[model samples]
Target chain A: MDPVREVEGRAYPFGLKNVDTDIIIPAHWLKTISREGLGEGAFEALRKDENNVFDRPEFAGAPIIVAGDNFGCGSSREHAAWALLDMGVKAVIAPSFSDIFSGNAFKNGILTVALPQEAIDRLMEVAETDPISIDLENQTVTTPFQDRFTFEIDPFRKHCLMEGLDEVGLTLERDSAIAGYEARQTGEMPWYAKGTALSA
Target chain B: MASKPRTLYEKIWDAHLVERREDGTCLIYIDRHLVHEVTSPQAFEALRLSGRKVRRPELTLAVPDHNLPTTARLDEKGHRIPIADPQSAQQLAALESNAPEFGIRYFGATDIHQGIVHVVGPELGFSLPGATIVCGDSHTSCHGGIGALAFGIGTSEVEHVLASQTLLLTQSKTMEVRVEGELSPGVTPKDLILHIIGTIGTAGGTGHVIEYRGKVFEEMSIEGRLTVCNMSIEGGARAGLVAPDEKTFAYLKGREYAPKGEDWDRAVAYWKTLKTDEGASFDKSVVIDAATVEPTVTWGTSPEDTVSIGGEVPAPESFADPSKQKAAQASLNYMGLQPGQKMSDIEVQNVFIGSCTNSRIEDLRAAAEVLKGRSKAPGVKWAIVVPGSGLVKKQAEEEGLDKIFIEAGLEWREPGCSACLGMNPDKVPPEERCASTSNRNFVGRQGPGARTHLVSPAMAAAAAVTGKLTDVRELR
Candidate 1:
């Protein structure tokens, strides 16, 4: 979980709408136990086209994806986020996102920027030729063409993404409080605290 | 003056709030966490790498359902049938080893208690009223039917819950769907939910937790309630609940994980108060006449792309939005359907009657009732019935549902999420259309290039016998 203050690179100009988790990475590819090397299978169906934008040399190693409204609509598989990160997608700019997908992306240090559809259209146009830059500190996406668009993100999520603090890190911050709760739980609800009692 | 009345969602949500953060997010205590094979391996691996053990293994339960083959594990001589695919084998193996290592209850491939995570949790009484539950699968909302505040979480959140037993969540808006009046015979909960999803597109319930109410839901059986809540994800809702009632308590009373004796009375007293207060308001409210909802089926790639069995496919020109028209056209092309074609006239090559959505004992009975004396059509190549769990399978067998299915020429198989996503051996061939009782009619969802039409179990059974998406009422 490396800190990400900014993401500066050419973005894949695919603004496809209703692009589901199944399309991001097919179910067959989810069979693997490992999360690594998933980029090869990322967008496997769309990549079947010889002239697919993902295969385009210009957008290779792009750190951003400008997607359409309601992106990542189906499934709670975290592999969708993992696949994007594997393919170097550090941020996704869209009009809206599936809440589960947004949470997954934030947990993995990927920024999901929700902007107006007009802003997304402008960004899509800018992404065609110039590199796009995202400044988490300023909450704006800028293009080499001097186009700028602002976005809103929950402050807590923004802080976590910028500082690379995952849920594990946050939980550890409250270790003492958690321990105290567990001690009380063991005393009050012994049946719930005992692993043997629950397994039955 | 009276305080502001809160919706059922608000009441349950407020009860679970442990801490309110400065960022307007709150930490909610998670009473139960469900895990399956497909999404949890990486989460467990992350925990291993970080050298953190499960904080409360007692609260977490792991099961392998997505990757398990829907066939008997033991053969004639008690020899185990081999898992052909290495990937599926590895995932099940990972769960078998990981659960014990992590000290969580593991229902493995051979465990009779093993089934779809969503089905087994409620069947075994793990999901309870007024509890905050999370799982790594979207259909975790199925538990909310029993009045729990439940929704899906990602693998990362699964790990978070494993380490802390709490989740940081921004509160969700509340939606009320009140379906009044009586349902016509042959109109099941599956049809009702499909109608709701079709009325409110796939993204309609986005960011809202829906509480289903009114006379129709109150009269529904627990299984019916579960079926309705199971597809809440299909309607784009974060979760859907039907508040705890007598039917819910009756269903859970004797289950293994249910509280007993004095604890039972206390639990019931608490659950009795889980309903919405009188005159409580919601962020959004919609009412439907349950009697008006006919037997429904999806005609396109999305769950919202649905229509009544007696209706014609939607013409792209009918849509005002160009994007929706384009999407409808795309769906028509992929489904090999014409815009004006009647849904019942479109033939299907396969029929699947199982999934977390509609694979309970009652679901099996509904399909069996339709197929009792009927035979599958000659054009139908394959028809399969996979129960939600071993318990469901045993119940169906005891009721002679398996005999009915077999006599009707439909294959009765073991329990697991077979043919739902084609992770197992069962799959609809490419370019073929299937009438499936499973959720999700996405193109290539059952298999690559496969077309799926979502329908109720009875509708699927009718289709199996007719070779098309026929209305179950007509068949009855």
Candidate 2:
């Protein structure tokens, strides 16, 4: 599923640190409990402000968001990821991301690119002027001014994103290995081997 | 080759090993999977798209907390705070849909049994000793209060645990936090832990699993042990542990999920040996005197920046390190308190006496005793008392603690993460300072620009009446 070419997108910049899931999408929005319509709640509190980052006219319809370090530091709410995706954030450029938040982003087709502080600062500047292009196949982000920065992603996530595969898809690819393991473990750990492996 | 006698960690770990990696991390089989509504949706989807079934459905349990509203059917039409935050509702929907599909137990809103996952896990005996339990919530470590090797996992790990009841993890080093002597009368486990964090400076136990030992822990109630372990993360420890004893067995003896019949006898016998051996050495050791700990409150953003009830707020220059001094000054300005003001005299706008931190029945009772006949200040907007668990909530109601909160003009609500950072419905307004019993007072965690002063339940209750950080010792 690894692509020979790169995937690219526009840069939507959000320059906030310690941006928690609660802020990404408030909890009260969780009533219907469906993933749909979550994008509306993305940055609900911030959107409430007249001058919030998401409401900036200059950054309208931007795809890539360049953010500060420690972005998404609190809560394990995946809706934060869903809402961001629905809002058209294809990739997030940041100094760092909260571990759980980053994983959720990657699984949901949003690329969480970790760049050095200098790289983020430069990207933020470039994003304000024009859109940035990220070639996932090439593992590089490029601007018209010839500024280029390469980012690394886990090979597994890279493969999935290239193929639009989720974690379930990735695991499905390993069916043969899983089946083989189950067969082997049946005798190794009988407690897990009862009936069909499905029950175990 | 001779090996050391196995501790509970060794026994459970050895029993669950599926494979050992060259790097020394074991592919450890997880025995129990407890999840909250907030973190399970993505994992559930991963399971669905992969066409995988739960490795053990019966072993997994789910509950809606974190983001469930304290006031359902609340009006949002021109309300100050949005009545419904759509994202949390969606997350809840995902759980409501998937739990039944996967055959996992789902406890939702006001369900006589719905509460904080960790609180309910033990009360129902779902968190047994010598078990490997994984939850996406960081406070999952609260289960470690009963000698379980429970740890918080990421969303990806949550997916892993769902598809397969196992994780590949490196074993952690053990750190023993010994709290000795009897606690001072007004001093509780909440103060004891805040004192530990204040002394240890937040990152003291990073990368190590802390086992709280000594007389203070032994004498502490189960609810108290939970409060202590709940904040272990504040000190940066992965989790906290307490070896199971008669107290642990007594708490679990007749719980809903506890082993019945002869299995009960065997489970207790096995649990007794879960403790560390006399000669067993730990990677690190720290000891504190319980009698010396007083009512504590955080003076800065981090949990470590705490002082005693009667102590004056620290001046920036009091910190010798230049960077710390600067940060202290910055925090003081952000909190809007004078550097030299008496710690016990800072005014607060609200009083929050619950959360996973100190929302047990005993915690409510402790707070209610102080608020029994007293009413809070009129201008204080909210006095939130969200219980930690349905069982605890029921117990408190039976004891009329709910009436006490009501009589004091406080709002008595059902269990949920109410004002805790896990969600944001019942939050403090920006720039408003409040006394809270929850762990962590990171900038604006209570709400956007809301200031939180972390204190014990007793102190938080006292502040409810006086509208300031009054000493709980004075109330007595």
Candidate 3:
């Protein structure tokens, strides 16, 4: 799922707001749960018009999607992120993401690159015709003309994404912390103690 | 030896807290993995690509409802047309194909049990009280109605849960949202939540877990409780929970996944302590008068942009915050509605009374009761009822609720998350207006250019009969 950690690539910007998951992979496409066949269905509605973004050859393989504020809202369907990923979108630069959508993106190793609307607007302008490069380690997005745009990401999310650690991997790292917490909770909060015959 | 404090949420949170990190994210374990067709494909593929099997296949339950078509493919507005595109067929096929391979118990299109995941999971009892459930669907929090610490997980999280049934997360602060007093006739849980959202505004519950307490919640039915908690996210709450009691146990008894005879008492014991303590504290509190909560509906895009049936859409200038002026104007324009218009005058082309948020047997019965023997209003193009679950559909039909709907000029359809953005078959056409029982009214939420007003089922029926939004209480 960790396709790439460092975002040193071109950003393709689709500046739509409140992009619900269904539009990402229309429910019409949800009849099957396979991944390979999804590319055909990704942005099917948008592709219906000959003049839409996906049909334009120049933006065909855009890596960065610049969405409007509150993008990816509604229904916690995670396929929305998968469709973007499968369509070759490595990062989504939006003012904000739905709480659920952001989590899904993180788990899938997709960077939910939240940037200030002003900063995103600038990238959107540059990305429309020119490729913009994002550097995760340095937290900057640089253009061919050497213009630099910096963004903020949750440091821990950055660390996990950089290290390609999924939740399991992250959890294993805290095995000791979990063990300690359990020991303390059992002794102090006996009534809260679980996993005995209670679940019988 | 000092011990840690335990609240019901904390106890559940702690048991599931697999690991704690220096940065405050907790890698927590998920006990039950409820899968829906909508978000499982990628995760299934990830499992395949990684050469992994489901860590606990038996603990996983799967169902496909969001994307199923209620009617064969049609171009009619508001009617659920089957998805005929090849790609859609492929997506559904993949889920059907992969489910058996993983040994996950799955309910499909023709399955008598197929329905919205939130509805099926709790009814099936897989999401038992005190258990931790995670699904790749947001309304996963609907399972919280049973007092489980259930929340929506994403596909990557789905893969994470599959490999180890755990998640890394930051915990939310606790907030007690208490609604007291008795609701008047014509009011329902849908209205109650609408009223709460309107009062608290959409962002009121941000960063918090709302625990519904007090007399109103106590008197609610399992279905009613589910409706309130279902839209907690719209209120910006991370999740919402209700403490389990006899009402909860009664709902679980004899369910497919609930404890059988020998396991019942022990199960109840574990469930009893899931309640908050007498002196326990919450980071915040919001109290409401249940008695005053009338049949409510949304006049604006956000759930918070709601008012009582008799109220008017607020003018942009009425908003104390100048920044809200643009949004008010945009909502007024997009909805094809005017500010200061009495909600009673808002015309509706369709009334859809089903979704994960509403569409329970009780919700259907309520709408049917209002629509009984009444013909749909002229110019009201469509009126349909899509029950949330197969079980609800079965019970409603047996009770003759379907006949009432039909007699009153409404089409009754099979169970699914119909018209709730889980699928497109039931969407309202762009530019048309619909009074929907679904949870959201975001732009294009129902369909492109579709203006949606969220309402209770009875209110929806009222709108269907009047061809415009009207006070349900007047008809009652």
The candidate maximizing DockQ is: 1
**Which segments of model 2 are wrong by more than 4 Å?**
A1-200, B5-11, B72-88, B320-326, B422-424
For candidate 1, write residues A1-200 as lDDT tens digits: 78889999899988887788888988888888887778988999789889888999999899999988788888988899999999989999988888888889898888999898888888888888989999999998998878888888899888887777766767668777667666764564333343324433
iRMSD of prediction 2: 6.3
Please report how far candidate 3 places residue B227 from its true position, in Å: 0.3
Interface C-alpha RMSD after superposing true interface residues, each candidate, one decimal: 2.3, 6.3, 5.2
Q: Where is model 3 chain B poorest over a 10-residue stretch in terms of lDDT?
A: B72-81
Q: Tell me candidate 1's fraction of native contacts, as a decimal between 0 and 1.
A: 0.48
Q: Name the docking class for model 3.
A: acceptable
Worst 10 residues of 2 chain B by lDDT: B74-83
**Which candidate leads the pack in lDDT?**
1
User: On residues B360-457, what C-alpha lDDT tens digit does candidate 1 reach at each position?
Assistant: 99999999999999999999999999999989988999999999999999999988989999688889999899999999987678999899999999
Models ranked on DockQ:
1, 3, 2
- Interface RMSD, model 1, angstroms: 2.3
Candidate 3 runs further than 4 Å off: A1-71, A83-96, A113-135, A138-155, A166-200, B1-6, B72-85, B320-323, B422-424
